[model samples]
Target chain A: MAALILAHHQTSPAERLKDAAAVAFIALLLGIPMIGLLTVDQGGALRIATRWPALFAFVAACFVGRLVLRYALDQWRARQLARDQADTPAKEVSLATNPLLNWIGWVALGVSVALPIVFAENRYVVDTATTVLIYVMLGWGLNVVVGLAGLLDLGYVAFYAVGAYTYGLLSTQFGWGFWSALPVAGAITASFGVLLGWPTLRLRGDYLAIVTLGFGEIIRIILVNWTELSGGPNGIASIPRPSFFGLPFKPPGDDPTFASFFGLEYATHQRIVFLYYLILVLALLTNLFVSRMRRLPIGRAWEAMREDEIACKAMGINARNVKLSAFAIGAMLGGFAGVFFAARQGFISPESFTFSESAIILAIVVLGGMGSQLGVVLASLVLVLLPELGRDFAEYRMLLFGAAMILIMIWKPGGILSHREPTLRYFANGGRR
Target chain B: MTAPAPLLSVEHLTMRFGGLLAIDDLSLDVAARKITGVIGPNGAGKTTFFNCLTGFYKPTIGSVRLNHPQRGVLRLEALASHQVARSAQVVRTFQNIRLFPQMTVLENLIVAQHNALQHASRFSLAGLLGLPAYRRAEAAAMAKAVGWLERLKLIEKADTPAGALPYGMQRRIEIARALCVDPLLLCLDEPAAGLNPRESAELNELLKHLSRDEGIAILLIEHDMSVVMNVSDHLCVLNYGRKIAEGTPAQIQKDPNVIKAYLGEEDADEMRADELRADEAIDQEAVR
Candidate 1:
């Protein structure tokens, strides 16, 4: 029996060598145009220069990497085979019980709350941190659809757009405050989520992704073309900022703003600080709702649906309702974050809600790990901060970002925090208590 | 002879897939709290019939009627797949064993009680707010799941992922998961497929206990003679999409059609010819 298991895992040495050769050959083929060829301009004419040294180095690296990886894999297989023969239990990592990982999420949360205070003098850092929090909120929202429900939503930003535009139009037209328009924006965006979900509920995986992608495009296009209501391409402007309850976060004007009411001198950083805390609370609420929902029966059913839809159906789980709830709830949270986006910026455009935004949000969720709430927080920080850190490499920022994402996938295909904790446990054993 | 009213009545069921006639015009009645064994050759449409009866497949033509205690009589084929399990209380296990693999064995059982808990949770609002009532209901569900795990001899593996367990344990876990549905009629497709002799023996005892003590009607599909012959109260045999024999185990053993079906027509004829060799010789002499 042990031999049968080993036979399945171990590859012949010849196959490994062949694979290494293929990697080297492909590297050479692609390297010719990429690393080897460089475009140079001379008197308005472009000429290609052969960078043979760089090309050879790239090919040599690919060859060496493949050989080393294949050897390591072979050694691991051998070790696993020996363990199987010994009938020893394999190791499993669970963040719920792991000594180091157990409190990492709480630690990250604490640091995030104190970040603005640490960099109180730097507006740029606080603003970037606010952007990161917005993404953290969106990642949690999209995690419902992609992580729990196993519904690949490539167009999640449409809901974000709906919330932003809802606030943008409503505050400018009906003059609703941020607190008043927030729920309305969420409800409308959720309705839009259902509108998209109802017809496409039957679709799954890539097909579902395509339909959602189209939905996002349709929303953006309509917002851009519908001149009368959406203000066409220019978008709504001067959306009112959120107030401190009723007191405005502005200079001491005729109406006696927040600074005057408290008998404090107005500082430009105060509004930024207030906005940062505002999103912090919202993002925390989003995380709370997702984590709480994950422990519920409906939440378990969502994860179960992701694992096996047919089994869920056989168990009397109403898959249609479960999936629709995931879509609506995820979209609703995205909507809340969008409302905050419009209020903070006081301006909006279709450009803010593009396919790239959806992709980035999805990347954060996947990079965090499907169905892992803390993973989203960690992933949002990496995805948002990485590009900021790469600011010096301006033109190569995206390239570096892509390379980092690929490296992460190679290291952990299931995401950085892929360990799943049981929603219910009968014994306080290896599983989560 | 008049018989007791069946807990389930499947009538004139026919399922076709494009050009293939998977199931012919078949009909059967499963009695209350009795184990009915369905045995058939490969591709004889045993699982197809179960799927049709359990509402997994909408039969090309037929009605599957279930006599539910609280919900009254329901046409199962008219309902969706989940409705068959939910309202009609007809639960089934797959031939290949489809447990929620990543879930703990205990979680798998609790998920089976999703509808009941959902109702108690007030559509999740109470659960979301962490109300005491929802928590009580959840604890009750957990207790029930633990009870099943204990009874199934799986309490030790309760926290283990269902997929990580041995094959026999996984099969039992699937059955335990089905039981959590409060099924009025339990359908098992090849429950003994992957089990060793000892596991099969334990399964027989479990099935008998469930049918006798719990009074849950069971429809078992099996090719294993030892299991089917010993446990089944009523046995039905099918060949080429038609019922060849159905009776008590003793009667089915002596059933001529069943014998011919199992041993091809030519082999049976050859065996009878050898037995009548002397008699045929005497008849030839009389003719002379």
Candidate 2:
């Protein structure tokens, strides 16, 4: 106790005593179960040992540790204050890292594409890489709604489900191919997005989130219960896989299949590689489309509406059209990804499009910086691969995931990359500001 | 002063929020290419009147009209908020500044011309393709934004995020953003509210230039006596949701009702008028 007070600066005895009391209270909460109680076996009989000395020792350690930490922090703050006063005029430090970060983004893109080819023999790595791309696509799609537009959509998976189901029904019922049904599926799902966004124009924040959540669940429940259209709980099965344009990936024949056309032996790995490239192209297109939109008038209006909706209206930017456009475009991209998803899986059910999936995609967008395109790729890799790698942890996997999310929030509260570059910059060499 | 058929006319404007009537049967006309000042005691429905004319709040009873040169005689009250700015060309700034804080000062101005640029981009299709047409419109928009930034002495801070700027600079940015809308009638609610005396003096010059040289009608609501006196061509005073007195600045200063309203003299109005009449008689005797 004397050492605790002597090392500190400016803290009164009463304050030091209060700090000790608070630490002691916390010690009582943590120390009792951890140190005081011990389970033991005595000749096949269970006995509970009361380790009061150990508990007291734990409490003392906590109290001393807190006092020392407080003393060190106070000393550091005094030094910081003196240094601030003695400053030789403040100098401007440039945060001019956009060009560097741009190079890194390009390197990441290259690595993502080369991953499957580099690990060709390792099926686990290729499969996980494919899964990461799907999530990357979904994250990019939801980034438009949640990040740029600042609309909190909890049920984004509804559009994904709509696209999957649309393609499923079309290919099975009408015999339309993946290439043909892709645009149709996207259009239908976009209309569904419009249907959801239209009535909720007046709602924002939590109310909008609740309505979207309800919309997602309503779609899932309908897929589960409506036996006619969706095949009820059984779900649609044996949906056709996407073909390589005019040729199908199958065994060689006298007629030209994919392998026979190339004069190569048939292999399932080719189809997997083909599907990997398919999503890569789709996700790249989605990124291109969104990045282009971000520079345009409607995109600026969407962001401005997020910043200040009343101000958007005052500036003659229609908040309703901007928000609805955001929803539609986001849903359209999600639908595109869904078409690829259904085609890749060859089977999907309502279980695949649950609220948890929406939450994960949204988590990817937020864990990335909101409104950042490149951040989505980084966040998706972190989220999807973390869980895949954590498969060895089994039951503890989710606990690790939650702890990582908490740590990320503590470390970078805005996000991993919250720095925003305005769409229209006045100067050509404008990075510092 | 001669009024040329009025640019904006608000007839019997009354705005009711719940049980409280914020504005009551207020009628006023704002002249074209002239600065019209709206002043009153605090909570005198000055902001509410602006809101009604700008179509933010639909008046419970009234009609607001704006005479656009090309798109003539538009009823502002019937239009939506965005249309009131875009179609009728009647723009307004807020009492509390509402710049898009996260956006750069120049981007804030660019967003103000959203409707025109959105149209020029052919509904964003041309924009996505990066067509030359959209580029031209965007370049024009940038030129306009840069011009305003230079005029407001904010060209140095053009790339700074708007929220990081000082309060007075943010106020100038907001006004500059409003000017980007190409408004025929600019309604400014307390543009001088947070400005220092020097800033208010700058604001006075800007308002005069915008009204006279730029040929935009200005409806200004200000509490700063120096600002209102320096730039106003016409002054209207409000008292408790009703128009108390209105005329040229000189006439409004001498009006007994205007003085009584500001002083809150309940029984002094009749007594004050008689005293003015007695003073007038002494002046007449001195003249004879």
Winning candidate number (lDDT): 1
lDDT for each residue of candidate 2 in A1-433, tens digit (9 for 90 to 100): 3354335456655776678778787888887888899989999999999899989988888777777767666777688778988874773333244887799889988997898789887777877777888988989888888998998999999999999999999999899999999999989988988998998999999999999999999999999999899988888888888988779887776668889888788899988888888898898988889888998988888889889999999999888889989999889889988888989898889999999999999999999889888888888888998888899999999999998987787578888888887786666565433
Off by over 4 Å in 1: A1-96, A429-433, B270-288
DockQ winner? 2
Cα lDDT, all candidates: 0.89, 0.88
Each prediction's TM-score versus the true structure: 0.91, 0.89
- lDDT (10s digit) by residue, model 2, range B1-288: 854798888899889999998998889999999999999999999998888888888899989888788988999989999998889888899999998998889999999999989999997999988899999999999999999999999998887789888999999999999999999999999999888999999999999999999999999999998999889999999988999899887667667788787775775575677767775775676589
DockQ of each: 0.54, 0.68
